[model samples]
Target: MDALANAPDILSATAENTRHREWRLPRRAVSWLQVLPLTAILVVLFALPTLLFLVVSFFDYDRTGIYPAFLLDSYREIFTSASTLRVYGSTLKFAAIVWAITLFLGFNIAYFLIFHVRNPKIRIIFFLLCAIPFFTSAIIRTMAWIPFLGRSGVFNQAVMGLGFTSQPLSFLLFSDFSVVIAYVHLYTLLMIGPIANSLSKIDRSLVEAARDAGASRWQIMAHVIIPLSKTGIALGSILVITQVMGDYFVVRQMSGGQSASIVSALSVEIQAMQYPPAAANAIVLVVIVALMVGCLLRIVDVRKELMK
Candidate 1:
């Protein structure tokens, strides 16, 4: 009689457990379904191309074109080539310089926009002004620098007229300086946009609390703001470095064939129909950039920021 009485309670508990599992299963399915499209897109677009290049990187190739045989000659040649070191050295130099300059400019501009600006309408107007240059084509923007920096150009003429120098600066065009200038003009926006987003998301009350505790403005910025904005800084660094490293035309045009880079080397190989070597070179660059991005992610939880 007791067993019969307790049977209903036991069955009720079982039903509750079953209902809990049933509820969880759909939630799990829905979560996965939400990410499915993005996963599919990544697989189709990025993963497949990377896999294909990785495969081709190991294949044998010659003047006769690619063959089915596996070989390491491409990578071996790339590592052994004398020009390879110089190209990468130049590329890395450009990347380091550009990254530093952009980070400094981007961080300060973002700080000003986020912390100092009080009026929403004025802030929007300032942001629009920053973004206005970006609406133009990159090619046009890049070429525009040529005329502006040339001998007897507007900038040179102004400087000379103002008695800043007797002659137009030769280093202003077709040199490393020119390349860096163009890169800063174009890529500073990439850094500013990300850093501004990060700064905007930071809690303003934290800054007020820090000031209340006897911290100066600089102190508050150094301790409170920088810690939270590291993710944006890292992201901006990645974008600037990668873009500088992959540039073929800007360096080419600005340096007047004096500087060479990994992309330029890759372009040379591609034009010469050296498929395996080009693929190997590309894969190596991809690996380097991936390592950099991975290191940055280890320092900051960008995933959490994105989730928020």
Candidate 2:
């Protein structure tokens, strides 16, 4: 009789405990529902197209951009040929050099913004200075580099006026160096944002504590700041590297097809109606970028940092 009487109360308590656990688990799941539309859009838009492109990359294309059923010839050609190898090497080199430069410059700028600029309004202003360039059309920005670096451009004029050289520098307008410079200018903002966001979250007191403990500036930066900023650095590097790797407009506009990055080569293939080769090149680029990003993620807890 006693057990029967206590049964309803015990059951009610168990139900309440379960409900409490459910509530305490997390509210994040609810937020994730908002991403469903984005996920659906990506699937319908990007994923489908990417899959189709991958499928077409193995086939042969005619002058009309029509693909016929074929074998692995495109991939084989891209892999086995020395010309294709050189394109890949050049693309990798450009991306690497741009990544390194952007990483260094972006980190320094972001650090200065977060640590040196104490005023919120002023900090925001400085950030806006970096961001405003993006509001302009990217194509326009690329074109803008031309007048500054062309034979009759501002850069050449300035140098000639300074008597730095007897002749206009031909190297500035249509070379790999120009492409890299333009890429750095275009992508530096991306690098700065992640790094600044990361650096801003770090507790200022940690730096102070290190200094109080007689740690030198370099030691504090190396041990405390750099480790904490690893996530930002990784993210920045990924952004710069990916942008540089897949870039087309800047390379084309600045180099005028005189130089061949992977992107420029892909553009040429596309223009020549060689869809299969272009698709193959794109797939290779995507794979390379994916591998690079995966490697970077290994060093930094990107997920955790992004969530925070």
Candidate 3:
């Protein structure tokens, strides 16, 4: 009778445990549930459009309309055409230059804001000052540079007034130099924001400890700050690279038809109703950017760092 009573208790406990497991979700399942909304949004907004582009890139198009067909002509032309190659090369060149300049400016600016500005209110004020230019539209800001850098504009006039040169600098406006100036103006903030965020996460004691160990400022920066801030640097680089690569307006307006970005060339094709070729161009650009981001991710595990 005692054994029979104990057996009933054991059976009831087993039943309760099974019910509990059925009600409780696994940790992995919870994570998936939390991310499902974002996944859906990305698929709808990004992945689907990319898929459409990939599919359309293979189609055929004529003066009348695009037709469903499998063709490599678009891809072949992009690879073989010298003009296309030049556009790609110019785009890459601009991206690399802008990236380097932004990285330098962003790192220093972020370091100043994060480390030097002891007052939180002062830091916020400085950050707001850096962000003031971004209150206006990008197009408006880009156009503002035209007047400033023009041969007869403020900068040239100032230089001429100072007797720095006898003539207005022709190279200052409607050239690669102006294009780079505009790019740096527009995108440097992108770098600063991320790097500041990364720098803020660093512990202050680590620097003090380094100082106590007789480490030089440069040594501390190279060993502690840079390594800790890699995630920010990588994020900022991606932002700058992608912005420069995809930009058409700044290059168009600043370079005065002398230079063309990949997007500007793609825009030309789209305007001419060359949908297939435009799609092909877009897909190629996407692949190249993806590769660049992948390389950065390889260097710094952004996901892991961010999670920590």
Indicate the TM-score of model 2: 0.86
Q: How accurate is candidate 1 locally (lDDT)?
A: 0.87
TM for candidate 3 is 0.90
Best by TM-score: 3
Against the true structure, what is each candidate's TM-score?
0.90, 0.86, 0.90
Q: Residue 235: error of model 2 in Å?
A: 1.0
Model 3 — which ten-residue stretch has the worst lDDT? Answer: 23-32
> How does each model score on lDDT?
0.87, 0.86, 0.92
Better by lDDT, candidate 3 or 1: 3
| lDDT ranking, best first | 3, 1, 2
In candidate 2, what are the lDDT values of residues 77-192, reduced to their tens digit?
Answer: 89999988987888799888998899989999999999999999999999999999999988888888889999999999999999999899989988887888888888899899
- Global Cα lDDT for candidate 2: 0.86
Worst 10 residues of 1 by lDDT: 7-16
Model 1 ranges off by over 4 Å: 1-21
User: What's every prediction's RMSD, in angstroms?
Assistant: 9.1, 8.6, 8.9
Q: What residue runs in model 2 are displaced by over 4 Å at the alpha carbon?
A: 1-33, 61-70
